[model samples]
Target: MTDFQTAARAATVAMRDVFPATPLLRNAHLSDRFDADIWLKREDLSPVRSYKLRGAFNAMRKRPEVPLYVCASAGNHAQGVAFMCRHFGVNGVIFMPVTTPQQKIQKTRMFGGDAVEIRLTGDYFDDTLRAAQTYCAETKGYFLSPFDDEDVIEGQASVAVEIEEQLGRLPDHIIIPVGGGGLSAGAISYFGNGTQYSFVEPLGGACLRAALKAGRPVKLDKVNTFADGAAVGQIGARTFARLRDVGLANALTIPEDRLCTTMLDMLNVEGIVLEPAGALAVDALKDLGQSIRGRTVVCVTSGGNFDFERLPEVKERAQRFSGVKKYFILRLPQRPGALKDFLGLLGPEDDIARFEYLKKSARNFGSVLIGIETTDAANFATFFAKLDTNGFTYQDITDDEVLAQFLI
Candidate 1:
């Protein structure tokens, strides 16, 4: 075995004292759908509902003498470190963005208990991270990076170690979700070239892909935080060093809306609750259909800290991506009979979820904003055709991001 493999195995052995190795269960549903033997390394089932706890525990265990720990994270990593801090009996100061979901902040506080102090600092994560680092440096507290530290990477490698032992052998393909690159780096170090690897990242925060293309880490201009767990704007320097050589072709970016589809599928069909990032690895399978047809594939479901409150938004995005839901602006003639005339165009499966007049005072016509949900994508084609045949003017605003954000 390689040096990384040796270290990873040792880490996995040490982790058992804290929490049992997460399950590597063969997913019959995925296997049947893909026509391949598929296994899911259920990192979501970890004590902190993420593989991040492994890294936190390993890092803290190595620094038993350190009295204080500091970190900045608005998602799973924060919970992981907080959980570890409580377990290790160390004081922790966690800095989070002010805009972070209250659910995540509450979970972190619950995990840390009295051992940790939660600080709501900056408006964005970068600001929160800077505040944490500055505080750590001044107070001489140990700063725990989510993915940059070597010790943390070693801990993450434990996932690969457990996978090998659980499966008895390496699978033909391993699919991993990438954020700051820690998990992908650790897994790559442990497995090396022994298995085919596919790296999946949320399209809005594909720092790994951007770094690989640039030959170094670069900050993204903007990031969509729908998949908050993996919405890293830049790849960590240390992680990028290890992952620099990963082929571009092996990296896949999943659209935020399309990822919602996978998240909903796992929840509704398999009774699995996956955060958007957790669903990344499994969602990539749709893009790799033919390539993995006859192979033994392992997908690491990274985290499942999904807030039930976001279910409506998740379902909305899924429907939009699946082409069954849409928002539009229609120019309706301002007459009492015009409303009754338009109602005749509705199909059996068509339902109006939202109807508001944008310009109610217009003398001749009114601008109406409408949200329509239908049984299938084709239903919209016929619906639009009927509208055109009847000379109705409308604009599909479902894909107009800025307008949708402001109006929807």
Candidate 2:
């Protein structure tokens, strides 16, 4: 075996003393839908609800004498490290962005118990990471990188180890979510040229794809933080080195909104709860439809620490992406029966989710903001036809990101 495979095997054996291997279960629903044998490597079911724990456990075990540990993360990684710190009886200081969800912060604290100190720092993860590193250097504590360290990469390869043993053989295809590239690198190293691989990334934070295009890791101009767990602006240097040769065609970018639809489908149909990042692999299946048919495919559901409080927002995005929901600003004549005329344009399945006059003081015309939800995406075609036939002046603001952020 190659050196990485040997190290990864050792990590896998060591991990058994910490937590049992996460399940590799055949997903019958997905198999039936795609006409393929589909399996889910349930990293989401890990003790920390993420494959992150494997890296944390392995990294810490390799540094048994370190009195203190420090790291920064928005959620999953922090929880993983905190859980490891508590288990290893080592003091840990975790820094998180101020805007991190309260649910994650609380869970991190619970996992660390008395062994970890939580520090709410920086508005962004970069700033928080800098602060954590600086503190670690000043205090002479071991800094645990979320995905950059060699030990962490080897630890993450344990996922591939479990998959191979559980499946009895390598899968025909494996889809993995990429954020900082740690998981993808580890898995790629473990499997080498033995299996087909695809890397799925959130469109707003596709650092791996950007790196492949540029031939080096580069920071994204901006990243949508909806998939907090996987929305990394830059791929880690060490990870990028390992993933540099990944085929460009095999890298898939999933839109953040379309990802919401997958998240909802897994929840509603299969009764699986997945965070935005966790659903990345499953969502990529749509892009691999013909290639995967009759083939055995494995999708790594990376994490399930979804806060239920975001359910409404998830549903809203799913509806919008599916084309059944839209927001528009209408220019209506301020006259008697004008409101009645617009109401008459509505179809039976079209429901008004929001309606408000932009400027109620207008005398001749009033700007009205309206949100419509329908039963079918095709229904919007008919609805728009009626608007055009009536000569109504309106602008669909659903896709107007700037305006939607301010007005919606």
Per-candidate TM-scores read 0.99, 0.99
Candidate with best lDDT: 2
Query: In model 1, which runs have C-alpha deviations exceeding 4 angstroms?
Result: none
Evaluated against the true structure, the overall lDDT of model 1 is 0.94
Q: Write the per-residue lDDT of candidate 2 for residues 237-308, one digit (tens) a residue.
A: 999999999879999999999999999999999899999999999999999989999999999999999999
Off by over 4 Å in 2: none
lDDT of 2 at 260: 99
lDDT of each: 0.94, 0.95
Per-residue C-alpha lDDT of model 1 across residues 1-408, encoded as one tens digit per residue = 787778888888988888998999999999999999999999999988999998898899999999999999999999999999999899999999999889999999999999999999999888999999999999999999999999899999999998999999988999999999889999999999999999999999999999989999999999989998899999999999999988899999999999999999999899999999999999999999999999999999999999999999999999999999999999999878998888899899999999999987899999999999999999999999999999999999999999999989
TM for candidate 1 is 0.99
* lDDT for 317 (candidate 1): 98
Clashing pairs in 1: none
Report the C-alpha displacement of residue 225, candidate 2, in angstroms: 0.8
